[model samples]
Target: MKRIWIIGLWIGFTLLCNPIQAQVINKPIVVLDPGHGGVDSGAISINGVLEKDIVLEVGKETIRLNRELFGNSLDIQLTRYKDILFSFDL
Candidate 1:
């Protein structure tokens, strides 16, 4: 009937007018893991560039650039900050 049609139209209009805020993420999480550490020296280039050192440097730079470029909007985490090893027994 016309009453049912009107009710349906009213419900549709109400739903459409409301904003759908499913999820609002303020900041994203990121974990940068640089392979190899301590005694375990990873790949080495012919020019004596260590892979572990390079990856670590890259991770550091990424954090720095993210802060400088994006105003530190992301939650960045690094595994190791120095030339040391970490036990992964857990």
Candidate 2:
């Protein structure tokens, strides 16, 4: 009937107009690369501090802060967690 058709159209229009939120949200990924390790020391500060050590500590601190502040919502990855040389093969 014509009345049934109009009711169906009105229902469809209402559904289309309603705002819908996405069910799945992709988490953001972050890669932290601390330069230099093992025998390769990136730079030497005037105070005799190694760049590799400093960078590694900084990377760790950043991860810690993110977890503490943002509940570790991001997928964070570290290139090297300790004093070891990593090979970059392109």
Candidate 3:
């Protein structure tokens, strides 16, 4: 009786945890913004490395890692992939 009860509980838990199939509509959008770019060098480290460059590099790496791990499971978008002039007045 105890074995049967445990089996029943396991089955119930499995069913509860399983993903349900829902009606397909539209997928959500994921936006990735790597802050600071162009004329805006952002912060400058003691080594003279620009914060914008570091942020961009890290962002790209993150995107790559996400792609490798999630594949098409997620929709990823980046604000800026390359360096560009952001503002002349900042």
lDDT of 2 by residue, 1-90 (tens): 999999999988876776341211355789999989999999999999999999999999989988899887777789999999988799
- All candidates' TM-scores? 0.67, 0.68, 0.60
Q: In candidate 3, what are the lDDT values of residues 1-90, reduced to their tens digit?
A: 999999999988876776442211233457877889988899999999999999899888877877688664445677889997545485
Give the alpha carbon lDDT tens digit for every residue of 22-87 in model 1: 121456779989978888789999999889899899999999999899888787889998898888
Candidate 3 residue spans exceeding 4 A from truth: 1-27, 87-90
lDDT of 2 at 49: 97
TM-score of 2: 0.68
- The collision pairs in model 1 are none
Candidates' RMSD to native: 9.9, 9.4, 12.2
Q: Give all candidates' CA lDDT scores.
A: 0.84, 0.86, 0.77
TM-score of 1: 0.67
RMSD of 3: 12.2
Q: Between 2 and 3, whose lDDT is larger?
A: 2
Best by lDDT: 2
- How many residue pairs clash (N, CA or C atoms closer than 3 angstroms) in each of the candidate models, in the order given? 0, 0, 0
